[model samples]
Target chain A: MATRSRALLPISFVVLLFLLLYLGLYLNPRHESDDSPMIGKLAPEFDLPDLIATGDRFSRADLNGQVSLVNVWATWCPSCRAEHDVLMRLAATGEVPIFSINWTDRPDSGGSREAALLWLGRLGNPYQKTGDDGENIAGLEWAVTGAPETFLIDVEGRICNRITGPLNDRPVPNPENRQEVRNNVGNIMKTVRKMVAGEGKCLTQDS
Target chain B: MPYSRFMNGLIELNKGLRMMQKQLIKMVYLLLLLWAPLSAAAPIDSLIFETQLQEDRFKQLVQEIRCVKCQNTNIAGSNADLARDHRMKVYEMMKQGKSDDEIRHWFVVRYGDFVLYRPQIEARTWLLWGLPLLLIPVGAWLLLVQLRRQRVQATEEAPVVGALSESEQKKLDEVLK
Candidate 1:
């Protein structure tokens, strides 16, 4: 009996180690979905050259007094291409105006402003104003990590939510129940509606 | 004469093998000498700081900050455009004479704690910091308990000296008589 229990001890230890390793598969060490520190803070300021209309500037001041989305995108990013159609659909809804920042179109990333303009011209232009961030100056101010990241700004120009990755509409599969998962567009709209209703307050601030 | 020729061939072979071994050692040493400078070479050379201290701080800051796009590598080690922008931002802030804490705070406000390579000790990371400490003692105790149990079992299984069974004792007494 002692020998059996002794044998079981190492086996249990191995089982525990495996369980911990298995748990790690589901654990993301990165921040939680809604845990972006930029959320609820004043959106970063930027003044950039317009992509389509040369000699025109798109500034953060224009975002004041309205709910809007600031989308960071680049011709170099494949995910931006994937999310372009969803952005077009969102634009068609006219729920909110979107401002675009074309990031890293300079020589290092092998992207050019001309390519960005041609891309928008071919795909329908969904932006109210498109900022050409060839030097990524505006991108640094906005703390943009990569393209296809969208920020929702409230009426006061405070950032409400930051949606990382491409705007996806695929239904999340559920084996237990076949309920459709809310797509990125749907989620954005829901938040926009709430903000429009004057309920979007800064989580960090008392006001 | 044939035997002597064979002996000479063996000695030549031995000399050739030694020469190859020396060449291998020399190659390894050359690689070792080359590796340090290659790894220590700065990633970004565009930003020129006014002072050496400021430049050192910039180097330290980049290593501490994780590249969000790359996930695994720090901004210093990553060639991602975002990392470049981040490095520029850090350099700009350092030029502005912002303290290290303030610069770190600026990133934390934008990217969250995930941006930091060394996460602060907080409510969320308690388990991350404490788990290894907890596991060490638990693992040691389990090992000790197992070892003790194994010793006990070994003693029980082994035949004891001067302790015979009843039949064996009777046979022993008859032999003695």
Candidate 2:
């Protein structure tokens, strides 16, 4: 009987180990929701004190009136710097007003508010209004995963497009991958122009 | 004869031994149940540490090389899921105790040196590594060219200053005034 119990010991351990391994596989961290975390959602609303003003506040109302582009960026994000020229050109063109929502710019995480301000000053501000989202309250609402994200919103405040990562208006040696970004940006601008022309609803009923 | 008493004592001892064995079996079963959930959560902490390590290594690597994807933005910050997965795979290899050279070699064997966040110091990558050393002279030459061009343009465009006539400037100034 003692020998029989000892024989069962190894078998029990093998069973236990396999169970844990399967559990880990089942618990694998990935998307747990059905939503795209972007499409079919209202743009995140925020009202925060302006970084540049003492008593004044910057809110969603600041984004009201006409279509706009919201660029979420940070000092720590290298791509944000890469897209600086493209944003400057977009602002310079004045085809659409660009707004900036600075995300997670606290100094403790290697992103400093001072650094963000200096970056804008040195690079030239492309944003009509800038809001400091130092704690990332706005980021959570927008489901932002990283920096250098640009969103195109219609005049009625509905998000029409989202471009992840940095924008490069400059030429590249490869043309194949370039089509994706170029096409997305082009479609967004075309839609924005149409919205401004008062041809249709800012958002389709199904959209 | 006291044989009856002896038989009773022997039977009692057997019962106690059986009870001890039953309790031991129960304890074993209990341990198995507890270990299952504990080990499942273990890998999450391990993976989180690996992710942090990957970020540190990525910064160290990208400073030494250009991004293969898009003309701008290094491999470190490209939002392409491929870049993110590559970083994670590097962490996984590191966790498995693979040396940095071995990891770089694995990438070179598959995607070639272009996949390397930092191109290795080899004959094929010699120019890539050598470019920064050669850049100082090249950059100076470019700067000189740009400054000279700017100086020429400034002189040429000086007469075009009337492009902003005083009356228009004064009118805009008056709005501020």
What TM-score does chain A of each model score against the native chain A? 0.76, 0.72
Q: What is every candidate's C-alpha DockQ against the true complex, given to 2 decimals?
A: 0.56, 0.01
Tens digits of lDDT, candidate 1, B62-150: 99998888888888988777787788888888888899899988888878888998987889999999999999999899899979989
- Candidate 2 lDDT tens digits, A55-135: 777677766667888899998889899888878877888998898888788865578778888898898999887788887
Query: Which portions of model 1 show Cα errors greater than 4 Å?
Result: A1-35, A169-183, A194-207, B1-44, B121-177
What would the TM-score be for candidate 1 when compared with the true structure?
Answer: 0.65
Q: How high a TM-score does candidate 2 get?
A: 0.43
Q: List, residue by residue over A80-172, the lDDT tens digit for candidate 1.
A: 998899899889989889999998877678779888988899998899999988998887777787777888888788987777778865544
Docking class of 1: medium
DockQ of 2: 0.01
Model-by-model lDDT, in order? 0.82, 0.67
- Which residue segments of model 2 deviate by more than 4 Å? A1-35, A171-175, A178-187, A199-207, B1-177
Worst 10 residues of 2 chain A by lDDT: A31-40
Distance from true location, Cα of B121 in model 1, Å:
5.2
